[model samples]
Target chain A: DAGITQSPRHKVTETGTPVTLRCHQTENHRYMYWYRQDPGHGLRLIHYSYGVKDTDKGEVSDGYSVSRSKTEDFLLTLESATSSQTSVYFCAISESKRLVGEQFFGPGTRLTVL
Target chain B: AQTVTQSQPEMSVQEAETVTLSCTYDTSESNYYLFWYKQPPSRQMILVIRQEAYKQQNATENRFSVNFQKAAKSFSLKISDSQLGDTAMYFCAFGRGTGNQFYFGTGTSLTVIP
Candidate 1:
């Protein structure tokens, strides 16, 4: 199995609390992405990194931030947790760009905010 | 901006039967890629199949296949001999061939009744 792992498989936090989700990859892929999955919205990109220290915001990046200090690790942080931010977050890594390559995804982290 | 649409909110299929999930996308670029990802109750976003815009022939993997209509901007997923394990939320997505960003649809929930 291509190893992509997300930490804190499940988390519970209170409003205004800070939280961080970690994604680690055993496969050395150039592209890594963070996405949030919701009931009606399905999944939306939150952030993505092309290389170490290179990151960009996705469609739904507000209230969320990401960092990639090393190729194997990408971190997603919530400055102040909110109930609306409660969702399952996934980490995906791809050797090629989104259009033509296969993306391997982590199991996901379900975060619940109160 | 590109947009992916999954018109069907939910679909049901009998065990060992066949089912098709519909998806449509709008993009200006001629070269791109379409994808179907399955998210089970566990919430992991798993790659089901992918189709390149340049390829004329459809793509199939095991019991999963894609009907890609490049000109019509439609990409649909066909699951043959559907199993209970195949019951999950399927998402339609689009991405530029060489770009890292992707556009995703809401999703279609497929239920396999055994």
Candidate 2:
């Protein structure tokens, strides 16, 4: 929980539509991450932001994009929602990248694309 | 890129019994961190324990302890006196202290029975 909140906890969208999930944190953590959880896959990183305006791709970044305009907010965008993108998304924040990988996660956002 | 592997897909344990979940990772970096996270039915990620690669001793938290073998790249979680609340999906993750990304395993579903 750690002061992280994801907007629209649950959403159902049609294929080809665009979807944006927002993550806000009051911890002022410098590192933020977006991850997707599926039935068989534990959690796959979609994207992460090390600082404002600096983001990088993760293991499963094919159909995802991310942006961080402020220290407290990070956004994940799906240009065209696909059925394969339907899953529970998690937003996590960490105090530092040079520390013990201690990350605090939000409640999570459940998105279903049909 | 580091990859985490959770070999057990599902497991069951009786109340007050002990259980172990196995995890392995492929990473060339010498300085990294390992973590075990639990996700209950509520869909919240709870950090159970963590271990640093440089530390030879295993990390423990109450009834939750880890058996970390750095040479074999294995990090396993052993839960003693398992309770009903321990039923959840557990994930193993690996991250370089300096990297912003974390690699998670497919997960192991644990069921604790009365």
Candidate 3:
């Protein structure tokens, strides 16, 4: 297991409120990814950072945003929380960008919006 | 959908028995990678097996093996001598050639009954 950790393992926020989930990694991985897990959707990529300050949108990046100011931290923020945005968010890291699916995932953060 | 498809939503196997989970994807690219990730009740995503598209041989680790068919775009996971601890949700993922993003299937839930 890579030294990856997600903060606020569980969170509850009201609709229209701002929320942020933090993912921290101790390993010096170059690529980091954010994903959301749902019942029927499995896991959908939200955003990913290939290097410091280099981020890209995913298939489900409409309502979310991410920032990677440094190599070890990736922050996912929901500008305004919505009910449909409630899901388990996961952070993953890979040693190289070419090995996209070969990643180590964090414990995951469960967020709920009322 | 270029997304990976997992036909089995749930399955059960007797302890020590063998079980196979199905996965299919749509892609025209020849160089890529396939991965199977296991998520247990602890909500931890663990990488089970990985197969590179260029490899003709299947990938295996201990009791976990993959049956990868490039022409058919099918990648299935086979578990041998299944144990109680094998109960978990399995996800199939597809990453394109040198791409930074991946597509995941909904996932298949496997339960090994003792």
Top candidate, metric lDDT: 2
Clashes of 3: 0
Tens-place lDDT per residue, model 1, A85-105, is: 999898989887544687778
Give per-residue lDDT, candidate 3, residue A86. Answer: 89
Q: Ten consecutive residues with minimal summed lDDT in candidate 1 chain B?
A: B95-104
Candidate by candidate, in order, the iRMS in Å equals: 2.1, 1.2, 1.6
Best-to-worst DockQ order: 2, 3, 1
Candidate 2 ranges beyond 4 A from true positions: none
TM-score of each: 0.95, 0.98, 0.97
What ordering of candidates by lDDT runs from best to worst? 2, 3, 1
Better of 1 and 2 by DockQ: 2
Candidate 3: lDDT of B67? Answer: 96
What would the per-residue lDDT of candidate 2 be over residues B1-114, giving only the tens digit for each residue? 688999999999999999999999998899999999999999999999989899999999999999999999999999999999999999999978787578899999999999
For model 1, the superposed segments whose C-alpha errors exceed 4 Å read: A97-99
